[model samples]
Target chain A: MTGSSVLFDAPGPKARRNSLITSIVGGALIVAGVVWMAMTLAAPRESGGITLPGMFDESRWDIFADPELWGFIWNGVIGTLRAAAVAAVFALILGVVFSLLRSSRLKWVRYPTAVVIEFFRGMPVLLMMLFILLVFSTGSYWAVVSALAVYNGALIGEALRAGLAALPRGQREAGLSLGMRELQTKLLIEFPQAFRQMLPIIVAQLVVLLKDTSLGYIVGYPELLRATMNNLSSYYGNRYLFPLFVVTFLIYLTMNLLLSWLARSLARRRNSGGGGRGRRNAGGDADVSPDQAILVAEASAAARRSTST
Target chain B: MDVVIDNLPLYLQGFGVTLLLLAVGGVGALVIGVLIATMRIAPVASLRWFATVYTEIIRNTPLTLVFIFCAFVLPYLGADIPYLVSAFIALGVYTSPFVAEALRSGINGVPVGQAEAARSIGLGFGQSVSLVIFPQAFRMTIPPLINVFIALTKNTSVAGGFFVAELFATGRTLANANGSAVIPILLGVAFFYLLITVPLGLFAGRLEAKWAVAR
Candidate 1:
């Protein structure tokens, strides 16, 4: 157990240097690629917004630099951000409600909730949004919101339930000993704790929901992806790559990269503190017990030797 | 009752297309996913980095965006691949990273000993991987990959933009022709999706249970 040989240890100086060099080279390649794209298609490509390539002129970057195209791109960004905000709020409410149902005393509540969770979880959001759109035309906006709520909420609901299950039973007993009613015990004691515990997963999934906003395009929401497509298609003769490269740089890639970055930071925050001593580790891996068993075996062996006097 | 009676065939047609797209997209995603996942975890640093960039870009971008990019943008790039082919290519590529992640986790679930054992028995890396590793990883990947399948199935709805003859698009076209009957038509489509997804979901659950440990 105390062997000096390092197995899966931290990267040493040489490895660290290699990692740094690799990162630099990768970053350089991305910049070079972007620059090459810009140089080839950026300047002369003009007028009716960015476009995809067509038969006559295959380069599509020219149209993107047009000012009018910026308007559509801007509008799309607003729509996406606005939709994501509304969905996040609704998803939180539904997530909390379902999480409560999943942990209820009665099988009726838990089983029904479980069924809904699986059904919604089982379905795809694209299908759900499409279904809600076609089925309830007036509620098209709500349909998207509902899909976001149901899907993200279900996953979050599971995260909350997992967090609650991971809680020490003593905490629940402690709440009961304090004379709180069952609902009150859950709401006042367990809910807050579980919510905090599951915060990382919750954050990451919400970012996913945010990115899922691009799914709005198919329903003609004219979101970022749709707008970009329109702008690119309009310019589909000469400036093929520029429009895509620029719009992708500004619109889809930048915003999502930020959200993903935020998710990572949030997870890091929770991970540093950890879920708690010995519950599930933050990455959702469920198999630390075997390692603990090994530790237990070593401890017992040492104890037995010490007692042999 | 009247709606169900009348719409049964409609639902069935949509269900068939749903299953077709689901099957094609799911299998394609699984294959691409393994390739991407292998690249993602490759021994070479550059390949791993490239795969990382690919997965991050794909994962963060919306599935609908990928659909649109494939259908509309690809053609404009002088890559006149037809809509159906592009839809398949895009959906397949979009779902692959997820499958890769799922399978990667599944692979990790197999203890390091299995690989060590295979190596000891004179298996090279490829033989050990395909013969020893993939079978076990495929089992563990069932549940999460089911989630990916659901995603791809739903994506068939997006193929509407590309004019692919899938469920949602079919419903959209039919409903538009019928004017404001959009709601009912969509409801029919929902029922269709439910029939397909619910059963597959159940099947995945059973598979997961069979492979799952006591924990």
Candidate 2:
């Protein structure tokens, strides 16, 4: 059966009629819902509705006409990108370091590495950011950047460790036979393969890191969400809140969707390209959510555990 | 350490609110998520389109924006929901899509032959899905679903940002007051969160192993 029609057989004439009727009813309900929301927005403030300058009122959206507003938005975009970029770089470096230590042959090194990764993964990024800000007295930007780096670095480390574990044992054996030490084998042979295999997952995690930059808003960082919602909204007054929200929402949506699309396409390419043995275990599915990648990583980790024991 | 001990009551109160948010939001996400997953696989084209659009829009937007909508925009639109209730709605609506995706993947994991067999036995879509498919799909979904909830445990902290006195907000207040004890205050908050998340994670691993054997 086709994937779409797996849940049902081909519709008979009677079934076709039933489906059409349901479609029409569903369509009507959606339209009615939209209309109801519009009416509510247009209603008076005394009735516990929108205050004067209702949503549809042209003046409510007039703030977009100011070139200065665009400048503020541009600064917010730069702030978000700057934090995300710094975090992503530090996260990758930290991920590599953590993964390397985690895969160490020494129990002392490996166990502590595992503990640290789990601790970071288990903690909330916002909590970590707040802790850094208050305890260390780092500026808000460093708090956001450092927290995102440490948290995501832990996740990426696990994913990379999974990637390393999923590699064919022969690859490592080959390296050793060619006169490489354990560290050399991992650094020169295993790490690059795991990095390439887990690239899409890393990219997906970066999207998560980017979304979390909005948490910077909570800590008083002037990121896009804070800039638009707090700065622009206060400057323009409550009447313009909805318009500012719409613009901010669109900007976040566009950036995230683009990154997500990149992640999916990367997974697809890796799947089709027949890169290496790890490909079979490396989130072969084209639509890889960050959690799904982690799930795959967890499964591989589990597999590694079972084999070792 | 003394700071945390002295503020123990405050920590417990914040912990309680955090748990309350997680419980309410988890249930809300599950209910809305299952409905959306059902729509995504339904026979009707429009329903499928609507579910897909809803999931994408919600998934791409940051949790902060969702909180902003619940905290600020809803009131402006005449929906004067309470802040706690608004936090519940924000977490639910924001998280439901991830839940839906997890369920969808679980459904995909089910063997195609099973669906074909159910259809050959003359089961309707609802009968086949609810009776045969969902039961099996949910079994496969438990581990991922737990991961989702673990993520939700951390997400409850976002409510703190929006005026709910959850653990993170409590930590902030405590840290501000006891500036010298910021470390202990924040660590106390982190301990409470680990109390929820770490166990869920271990449970997920255990269940995944058990299910793998069953499969």
Candidate 3:
């Protein structure tokens, strides 16, 4: 579908005037809201008092320069990165294994694989993390990592399964026709192509993982969020809570945006590299069919379609 | 199972809060999402730009931050909001962009001919969109909307971090109280979440299958 609609006719003079009035009113309302918020924030109130100008106070940001506070933040960052890295790697492995099992020749494997994937996908990461931490006496680090792995692993697996399903039926058939075993056909032919297609989504899921790591704060994990909160409460009490939250928000936004940028670039690279295994929508090989490829293809296509948009 | 039964009252109260948050947040998201989606596809360039910027900013940030904003920023702005209200606002605002994206795609999925036909019959833009385009788009969006609701339900657990006494918070409190029975407590908690999510998932699957045929 096209990005923008072109079905409606151009506005006539009266319609243009109406549009102008609507735009002006809408703009005014938004500007008014912003002004109101600024006024409220800057208002000298006993409770919830945070003046707009206070955000720029040199003392408010001094924590950034303090070695003690900065050290804690650095530790938090390192801790977050460590967990994310471990989770991403293991989740990728889990994704690949689940996808493989889901696509296996054995009928028994697919049912259990699907059950596990769906269960994790539907389960909240916070619930899983807290459950693991409490049940196994695992610390926050392992709790965050394991929960992320299970949830995102299922998601990535689905993406890969879709990518595999998207391939022409002939891929597996060609491998078999060439005297290759099912395992060899899958490993050499389908897996590589599927991995390429799934790369962008995998990167996007990593960004999701990073965002979820913030949930580690609920368990008292010293991640970026929890660290920032601890520093805020101790250093300034609740005086600068909003400002610190704003700072934390910006950091998370920047990181997530960077990940999305990376994913987009990967998608662009895949699209522009021209006709190879990476080429999606390769026509003319429509004849070959695997037993359950249609379902897998639809599932993967749905997953990818949601992510790409 | 025995743990769940013993803590039945606590679990029930927590789940009630969970449903309250979800119900309120779900409706709020749907309304705001449709408005944003409308702005997104509207004829006004400024509206479209605003919608795009809002969606991008909201989608890129963590939901936890959104909760923090509501819990802290709203109070900073002089509103003494309760934790449940704060959680509801956060969930609603956070989920709206995703719902908008889904609805925007649904809008796009509608045939251009549908709009053209509405115009041909002298329907104004408002009537055409509200009557013709939206009806079909809403049908197309139901499954994704359900998915968003499911996500929002799971997300309400984050409210526990903000001290909202939801199911997760309830579980945490109970587990901490009965340290030796933490496993049973968590199992009960997970089961409660599943009680909400699993049926919704099955319903979504059913709707999806039915719609795939209708398509």
Give lDDT tens digits, candidate 3, residues A90-209: 999999998999887787999899888778876778989988887777888899899888888887897788678767777788899999998999999889987876677678778878
Query: Model 2, which residues run further than 4 Å from truth?
Result: A1-4, A47-51, A177-179, A275-309, B113-136, B213-215
Highest-scoring model, lDDT: 2
By TM-score, is 2 or 3 better?
2
Error of 3 at A287 (Å): 13
Which candidate would rank higher by lDDT, 1 or 2?
2
Please name the candidate that would achieve the greatest TM-score relative to the true structure: 2
Q: Write the per-residue lDDT of candidate 2 for residues A57-167, one digit (tens) a residue.
A: 788888899999999999999999999999999999999999999999999999999888878888899999998888788999999999999998988898798688757
Estimate the TM-score of every prediction.
Answer: 0.75, 0.89, 0.87
Residue A86 of model 2 has an lDDT of 100
Candidate order (lDDT):
2, 3, 1
Each prediction's fraction of true contacts recovered: 0.23, 0.41, 0.33
All models, RMSD in angstroms: 9.7, 5.2, 4.3
Off by over 4 Å in 1: A1-68, A130-140, A166-170, A231-246, A275-309, B1-11, B110-139, B178-184, B206-210
Among the candidates, what TM-score does chain A have in each?
A: 0.71, 0.84, 0.82
